[model samples]
Target: MKNYFLEISFLLFLLTFSSLKAQTYARNGMVVSDNKLASDAGVQILKRGGNAIDATVATAFALAVTHPAAGNIGGGGFLVYLPENGQATTIDFREKAPLASSPTMFLDENGKLVPGSNHDSIKAIGVPGTVAGMFLAHKKYGKLPWSDLLSPAIQLAKTGFPLTWALYNEGNYHYTNNSTEFLKNYFIKDDGSMTSFGEVWKQPELAKTLEWIAKKGQDGFYKGKIASQIDAFMKANGGLITTQDLAKYQAVERAPIHGTFNGYDIYSMPPPSSGGVTMTAMLNFIEQANAEEIPFNSTAYTHLMIEAMRRGYADRAEYLGDPDFNLEMPLNLLTSKDHAIARFKNFDKNKASVSDSTSFGHPYDGENTTHFSVVDREGNAVSVTYTLEQSYGSGLGDPELGFIFNNEMGDFNAVPGETKSNGQIGTDPNLIAPEKRMLSSMNPTIVAKDGQPVLVMGSPGGRTIINTVFQAVLNTILYDMPVDESIEAMKIHHQWLPDVTYYERNKMSPDTVRALEAMGHEMIPVGQLGRLMGIQFFPKDGVYFGASDSSSPDGAAVGY
Candidate 1:
């Protein structure tokens, strides 16, 4: 048994090292994404006379088949697009609460929260928007046929693809605990064994679904046989969705939040996604603090950035939410230079701010998600982030559909306005309502210089996503590092709740950690922080640089 364990350990090490050996480089057109197969699919689109938007559509569909844990059609996400000569815009396809859903749906007879009921059940599923989102984007900016864009993914799903060791291990780790019966049925064989690495994995059902959608577009998924399957499943399992809910779902077109930091113009998803507002606020605070004066990754710089992030998160919890539901968000105040200066003035360089001491207006507040970036030679760029909310969300995937649904319903505050056992407010701007979209932290962003895109980036770590993207932007603009080093740098996150600061283990030096501790931070070390996908373009030189987080084994930055 000891020798067997040793052999497995050695093989895993070799696999990790081999994956790491693939390095970052520059190219003319590129796609950087969490899954290598998805990146290849996007590159193939670019090679076949497709533009950036076309490539992004292809990549997203391919990810649905290759990285099923997070990439999903049953889930929803945000997309930020920048055309060479056109204005930037965002597509909001975030999952919405069913019309029948109420604020108290997750509560019990006692009006108290029922812990696991919100996450691991059929009722947790929200009406998905990925198909609508993809179709709309393609309609507006796609240079290739919709059928052509989906062909790669359909082929990969129908024909078998080799399972990597990382995927095999992740499947076993997530499913073998008997946490979800459906997940076990999908990954585990009847012979009492789990699927092994290098096995040929096929999803013919998913292929058929994609083919139907390819022919009929969004209507195919939302109003046809696919919708019937979802409705049937919900009816049999005490779920809230109806055929009406699926048919009523529409992808919204929102104006991207615009900001300027260090001579670069930034565009990201607007409200309903607090990420853009919060991240922009942090950048404003950092710029106000003259953060460029400090050495990159130094203890002083880290301390300052952490403080800014702390305040940004606080603001997010207190004020940001779905604009349609809560129309009174402090948009002008939160993103203003004056507000940022005022917020930074409260920070004490030598000490961390206590959670209780923070005030409102004054203020405010992880699982499975994926991000991808693409850039075409025409200078069009796309940065997108999507998710299932958690690994195998709801664990209630339709076996016939060959896709997993999102437990985004769990994202809502079940007991709004109530104080938690941990001493934090339950909800305000993000309270649940019928058919309202939950607040999300997925920030797909693009940075431009005088109307020319310079950086396209985003990440997946639930709440930690905003901070990861914030730090990476700082590394590139303030520290003058390439995209690779910017993504690979150590990260620290403070969400202004529970009063605990979490830092990635070994990413920070011991002395830096000790200094932060001395400053009154209740620091906790974590193994990893986020998985970011980014591409940096130099319009003057016509060069493109791609970066994928090394922490994710399947991630790759492919270019041509």
Candidate 2:
């Protein structure tokens, strides 16, 4: 009788586990982002019959309220949108250098790059494009009312949201870090103490700004009172942006870069985002190498990947930049399979590729960034990576407006041909210039299998964004891991100039690190390479599975 009872209990446990696993399916819609409130806001839009674009707009705005460190309204980013029945496209609202900026803006009198000068000053601010970008995207594809999409964020700001441990940590860091300014203004109390976790944090001023935008549309922020306020602020703070710059800002719509890898089509943002071109080059190089024979995450496979990354980044430094400025960017040749093969031919699998030694054919010549993905019931999808370039960006807050502006100026080549501390040579194509967009690594990507959207993914880690997306795609396609497991897996990054292979601390075994080092690779164990968010679709099963990287402690993947 005891044995019979034990068998029945075991059977019940198995059934319960199976039922829980089956619940991963989402036939209606999915929203995966690095913040729970933001994901819930997007999901709310989907529940209200909003399309993917609407949900994305809603999510982006909500992120500004919930994840202020990177998700921002004062910054700029790129987006890739896939309609239910049309070709995928990208929107480039990347921040442009101020009209008053010059090529040597960040250089000192001695012609040396000033340490932290570009990042910690008001001059670091660019002519912001987040408002313009979202407005244009919504005007083109959003299904819900524009005001409706922004209401959630406005309401949250007016009322308040509980501070999560992640936010609390950010506030604590600002209190201690002398470089931080705006964060203290918003998160610190009158008594000079930081807001603790779970405390209600409100942004009445930000709410006012959102309310103005909701009522007046694009002109509300870009042309009227807001623009005048920004101009005044800039003049007072030594920033170069003017009311004319704000009024003239426009988000450009561009074709998404489409490439094929392992029988799957990958769609990503194009320049002034270097992400698409870089990711395409890496994928093509891997394809040319016949990398399928190697096991995923093994030492051999990791080495091959590092070499591929090195080659891609080398090409990036030499060729890529703002297409509007550098008309000679070799987009076709860069993305061509033939070019990839030619580039990979010189790679030696036995040893590390020296950054300065390899000579490539003359061709072209390309921070903190945030990403989120949304897929609605009608099969429409949107993947966006936006940012203010650093944690709390520029550290210069708009006191009256209550938000921080991006320090994207830090991304440009302060001086052409300057060698950075990391040993990478700055290229002329990306040199600072008036009205030129700074180069970016924000890659918002989508994967479709057999003409059906299967994966919507992207990440935030500046240069690490490309490789993180590459590994995640391979995780789902090659390893066939579940979406959650795939995002949870360890990630490693190598930018040719850095010459150091950074592996996620505690994720790679000591044996793997030793093996990589034995191959003449400099192995540096780092914490949390990138915070990725993804939604994987199983067409046959009529379900969607979403995953948020555990590194983002408060991230959420909501579906219905």
Candidate 3:
């Protein structure tokens, strides 16, 4: 009887693990985000007959209340929308420098970076773009009322939700590390102390704020009461943003960057975001090399990937920037097939290329972020990756407004022509300038076949975001990896500087690590690289399969 019980327990464990690896399938709609509650909020919209764009808007708002670590109204990011019928487009609501900002805003008199000024101070905050982006997206593509779409999030804020282990840690971080009097307000804990696991967290102030947006739409935040409050807050503090900055912020609708890889059509965000251009270039290189024949994570395969990343990121640092600011950007030349092939032609598969000193080709190029993907019954897909720069952002929240401000100014190259070996770039393209949007790695992408989206996905990993999204595309289209495996696969990151390939600890075999190091490449081990959320469409069965990366303890893929 004891042996029989042991056998049953073993079988149960196997079944549980298998189920976790399997996709969550649905017939009409699917929403996948880093937080289960946020995914449920998206599905809630779909249940009310909302389309993909509407569902995504709901999800983004819900994340603002649930995933406080990254999801934010005080931050900004990119959005890629692939409607079933209309032309594919992207919304660039990325945060911009305030009018009072300058190139040397974060520098001292001696031209050195001010300690913690760029990332942890009021000076680091930019004009937020998330609310503007969401409103613009819904204004163009939404079927449901804007207020109705935000109902779920407002409800979550008004009542409360159980605190998860992940949120507990984040709140503790904010509660402990909060420095100034302005930043001392707790994340969601009204009692001013971190909550225990499973404790309910309610934000009455946030509910009132959402109610304003619900009633007045975009004007609710940027024009009237909220704007006045922000102006007053900044005046009381030392922040650069003012009522004029908030009132003038607008999200631009741009044509999506389109590319083809392995017969799969790809649509992604354009300039200011290095994602699409760099990812397309790297994908083009991998395709030209016929990398499919090489074993995954093998020494040759790893070398090929690193070389592609090296060249792509080098170009990114030199050329890409906000299109409105930088007119000389050679976006076409950088993403062209010829450019990719030339960049890869001299590659030696057995040897890794040096990435220490990066120089740009005549053609040119270009943070924490969160991503959620939504697909409705109509075949429309929306991919969004938004963030507050660093987790919890500036850690400063006005108790009355109840939202954290983003420190996105740190994304800028604080010093000119001062690139470093520790992954800091001081290139001209990304230099700080007033009213300019900072360049980003946030690339929300969709892959379609025969003009129908088959994959909707993206990730958040600061500099590693592009590479992580790049592999997700390759894993699905090139490798035929399962939906879950495509996101859960071992990932590596290589930016042009630092020249080190950072791998997830213990994810790769020791033999492969040694082989890679023998190829004259520096390798370092780190913790998890990204938390990816994605959905795979199987048109033959009229089914959608959603998968959230296991790295997010509370993450779930909700479908119906």
Candidate 4:
């Protein structure tokens, strides 16, 4: 009887393993973001037999309607796609420098640096490319009809969406001190208070624009009435974007950055994004450290991760730039085993490394951006990262189209400096050269095993994008946690500046914090960390599970 019981137990173990593997099916899909309706809209597309590319286009269109404060048709972004048989590809649709923009545009008459260029329409706006990128992705791999994918966004824009607490709060925070008449009339309530949560906000003009695009295809915006309006508005407002810029824009398809972690293939956006190199460097350094042996979330693990972040960020500040303009970076800096071994040689358990020691190189400018991940029924996956440069973009919107413009010009270094040996300058590589794309920190990534996608994830946090993605992957892979729990876990970030480590309040253990403090580290409690979205597949059973950040008001993972 004892022997029989043992045999039964062994059978049960095999069944459990089989169940886990069987859960990975083509039909499983997930969408996550700061808006619930948008996330649901993407999942709906997935449920309707759309592949990951279709779902991404759908979600992106919906976000342009529902989350106008952060996403829009006026911005630009990067798209990373992984097909079943080939290497991943990255689409660079990042906003470009406007024709009127010059290297000295932000400099004062006295040659002094000027602050707040991010808020100026003349200095803020870039040639928008969001629409072009979406259309391009759809053209290449989307299975659903483009018009069908656009219908959901059109409905949301025409009928309006109720404001969530998060949206209401953020709007109030950003618009409180605005003195512009245009913003006051559009975003503020009648009684001098910001619009409250639950209020229905309708964007009729945007609805019409989306509808036009649905009917006319890509030409709807680039060459039709919308383009004319955008050109006229920029001309009137002293901005540089013209109808020609819109008509000339095209999304470039480039090779995706490839790396490996514990036999899983990792793919992400390459330059002009710092995400690929920085994330790989951190992960490579950690791999050399044998970080898995440290207790998960323990002070030692946290400390080492932060140290790695510091080194990676320092490298980012010195060596990263637009590859189109700069000489090819030593890609080996992040992929070489010898380089990883050398980086880990400086690891010290009890003291913080000086910035100068890690800051041996000079990278280019970093800018604001956001990311989203999607997986659909056909086993295809896409990770897209989009941005308007900064919040409210250039703080200028084409009055007629109801869209904000991108302030991508601030991504250029305004200071005059000599070019480095690698042909990178602190200033010009990402500067206001005609049609040059700005450098970004948006990193969207996918993890595949045995040539099939196993995980999809990305985040929105400007310079912290790499750190957020790296930690989440560690949680899911090294720590062996569920997708939801892994994303929900508290996160810490170190940007190699101000010489302090930032932590999310009340999420990390007090013991961990105490241990780091004792190790001569300065720690500050940050209220919230960057928002992350992810989905994991159980290959054996063909089931997909999704997870989103809990701190976000509207993020969700819905699976049938």
Candidate 5:
């Protein structure tokens, strides 16, 4: 009887412990996302003792499989890393212009802006850099072998994964207007109904490509059979990308743009991407506002931030561009404390500032993008942001290769006007040039405390990237909120274009909206705010916490 009772007690204890563990947060780490599997992959890597960069590489590959509509292997981006040694680095692997590109490519015979075709094979391409960038990051900081890190994505792609409601909606929205053969094969049913959530989606070709990459590293894509295949596809489809473009593609490692925000060292990507400079300038301006004392979401706080956004965006439009080409751009505009303070003097508390009135000549064009953040047990951090320029990326995909190309050429401004005070001509330095990279707005940032990394943050939304990062940093460091709440809170964006204040509905306070309206501001309800991802470290416990954007269907943070 005694033996039987002990056995029963042991069984009961085991059951109770299992239940408690299930109810509790994942202590090995947490990965929150719209797509649970993608998050799970990251958590798995962390559990296996891979560093943050390795986990990030795994998560990115998983995203490419499960969240194909947004996450992609054919795209390029920026990666910001803050190692435990206190060295911050940024890898600028953004897409590059094709060798055939020209500054006037987007202009018509009459010198007017041409209407861009969303499906022109010739215009749908850029030199992709994601593979190179990921490989470089892994080589530098990854704990796991490249093959092991890629296994999850390969399995998911080959065996298939279930689609979420968000993927269904986005796929339907993107493919609804025109049913191309490619769309029919991948996304649509015979009756033209979009594939619904819970349906299994597979990409055998992507799986094969991933397998090749795993075996051969970046060489498999850039100079091997994959490059040959891409060259053939582009040539046959009237695209300008050539094998030379692929063979010559390189991911440049650059020094991170650094700034001090309330004593925390902020690091982000530099030129060819305006995110770093613009973000630094905005934060510098806000630092002077003494924002810590203001109530969270108060009218005063919102007004000050909105005004500062206006100033920062104005600078982004007039003074920022591809540094290799734009030699006249006032680099001092962001680094000089005096210039940042001088710009702040123009902010008016009671009125919206007109962008053109405040800044010098020539407005520039922009593009859309995506961002993700990762942190590991060893304190290595990575914030990566990439894009295809626009939704569906010119709506052209190579069926054989199973990937769409980026339409980054449209990012350049078509019309050039008078020179600005910063010394640039009516021509945008970002104007398309042969083999020149288009200017991007992707900002991947890492924040350090006392020379050690404490936060890794970034966002995706064209001109809004800077503003989103600015707000999230303030929310996390100054407002003192957890990562999840800081990202979930309502957000506002003012890009100094059309001079309108765009706010996410039901996110910001009602009083804040009213205050902006009273200040002669035009308010528009935006369906969604920018997506942000961040990780915060707790020095006392030596544990790191991460959060993805609540607005994203697949934003997740996984730690171990």
Candidate 6:
């Protein structure tokens, strides 16, 4: 295994790369997040002798309060935990469709989609699983008391934290420009204006909600008064969630999806999330084709990467979904190296492959999510990525509950059997079903060398998540890039249906763009890709280093 400790020594290394950007370094534990306060809170948990699992549970809850745009208890996601002395495992907390939901729920009388019903309305919310997921992680692996892990978030919500310019800017823009009345109510002051930057923004109701969980654990939110209130609110607002759905919601602890990438063990959340298998397949394609020999930023290299992404995404739409719902899913085949090589038989190396249809069963997630990575002194690592489906979720919040509801129901294939060229997937495996967890692209992952977890990584960009994470692993382990560069490196995404390869604007040379376009690939540009949080550990001295995404204005990598 390569020792990054020697590769980027300026901050966390004993050697130096060429003018590498600054990175946060530490001798023992580290926490990385897009929210500084959330990172600090996780580091505090580490300082208090908590394990990586404890710190991550704390960090996720803290983000729920501090970064409402994505961090959420009103939403759900996946968590991967790697212990120094124990087996690696994952918690699948991807949200479930309400019991009343159906394959045709989003369709109108004419069988067309009910306009805005999938995301813009009350029916979009799923039975939330964040609280249950965190609870189970703590119950099985947490070192600190469950209540202690929640204290930081509770305090931040109750006592208030200074609103950052990013939040203020984004929130105010929506508040003013959005036509929805509910959108205008977010982050409002008593005078009916949007909260300003640098002002203390408090959510006392959210604090109370946290207090309930702290006192009674997951039941605090999924049952009793909170569940009753949610049911009542749903009834009043024409939402689909019921108290039964809340009571029946259970965050499952499933075996980690395991793959070998160039001798490193890649462990991640399994089905219900297409991330791990898809990413591993992409890695397999790259390794099988020996594409690493090509220059990293050249058009040829980008073409190969985009083809791999297209195939992986294409297979995802056809073969993957909630494992419990699709018992026949070819999990082993999809993640195998052989399957990857089989996929590349059509690769021309010089051309971009068509992405209209996948090789398997059929065809086709959100870009609004948050991820954080935690590493404790004992060598334990935790990677978590969660989301509410969109910015401000459903654009609906309860003053009484003090949290936005996730529109995650939209994640399920809403229009069955109607795959579209515009990126709308209607694959059967992902069609909405009662009590089924929607398929996700949230791939929180850990890379272990010689059975020791060395890297904990994940990102949030909906469908872009899998590609970003796939590259992060390949960047660090295969290309041997420094931790910061692994995260900040220019990235591209190509989910199958859209048939458009998106490159981060200004990051790609115009010549490179034209060169890629010459390969029959339709290329577009986006302002950014996924916002990643990552950590690399060097066991020689038990040192830990963190790299937060540069895209987040308030993000940081905190360590001690």
Q: Model 6: how far is 208 from its true place, Å?
A: 0.9
Off by more than 4 A, model 5: 1-34, 117-121, 172-176, 188-196, 357-368, 418-427, 509-511
Off by over 4 Å in 3: 1-16, 19-22, 176-184, 187-193, 358-367
Badly placed stretches (over 4 Å) of model 6 are 1-20, 179-183, 358-364
Give the alpha carbon lDDT tens digit for every residue of 471-523 in model 5.
88888888988776777677888876666788888877777788789887878
Query: How many backbone overlaps does candidate 5 show?
Result: 7
Residues 1-560 of candidate 3: C-alpha lDDT, one tens digit per residue: 37998899999999988766756999899999988899999998999999998998899999999987789889999999998966899999999999999888888999898898988888899999999999999999999999998999999999989998888876666567735554445544655666777998887888899889988988898999899998888888899999999999999999988888988999999988888999988998888888889988777877888888888888888888889989989989988999988997788887888766445311111145689999999899999999998877887767798888898988888877777666667777888888899988887999999878899999988888888899888988888996799988888888867778988888888899999999888999898888899999988999999999887777889999
Clashing residue pairs for model 1:
314-364, 315-364
Whose lDDT is higher: candidate 2's or candidate 3's? 3
TM-score for each candidate, following the candidate numbering: 0.94, 0.93, 0.96, 0.88, 0.88, 0.94
Candidate 3 local distance difference test against the native: 0.86
At residue 34, candidate 5 shows an lDDT of: 30
For candidate 5, list the clashing residue pairs, or say none.
Answer: 29-559, 31-557, 32-556, 32-557, 34-553, 34-554, 417-426
RMSD of each: 4.1, 4.2, 2.5, 7.6, 7.2, 5.5
Top-lDDT structure, candidate number: 6
> In model 1, which runs have C-alpha deviations exceeding 4 angstroms?
1-21, 24-26, 188-193, 357-365, 419-425
Q: Give the deviation of candidate 2 from the true structure as CA RMSD.
A: 4.2
User: What digit string (tens of lDDT, one per residue) describes model 2 on residues 473-502?
Assistant: 878876788877777788888877667889
lDDT of 6 by residue, 1-560 (tens): 98776666545543333223557889769889879999999999999999888898899999999998899999999999999877999999989999999999989899999988998888989889999999999999998999999999999999998899998987788888854565577678778878899999888889999999999998899989999999998999899899899999999999998988888999998989988888888888888777668888888889888999888888888888898989999988988888988998998988777765423332226668999998888888899989999877887767788888899988888888877777877787888999999998899999999878888899989878999999888889978987788998889988887788899999889999999888898989999999888999887867787888778778889999
User: Which residues of candidate 4, in runs, are more than 4 Å off?
Assistant: 1-27, 171-179, 187-196, 357-369, 418-429
- Candidate 2 has its poorest 10 consecutive residues by lDDT at 357-366
Predicted structure 1: lDDT: 0.84
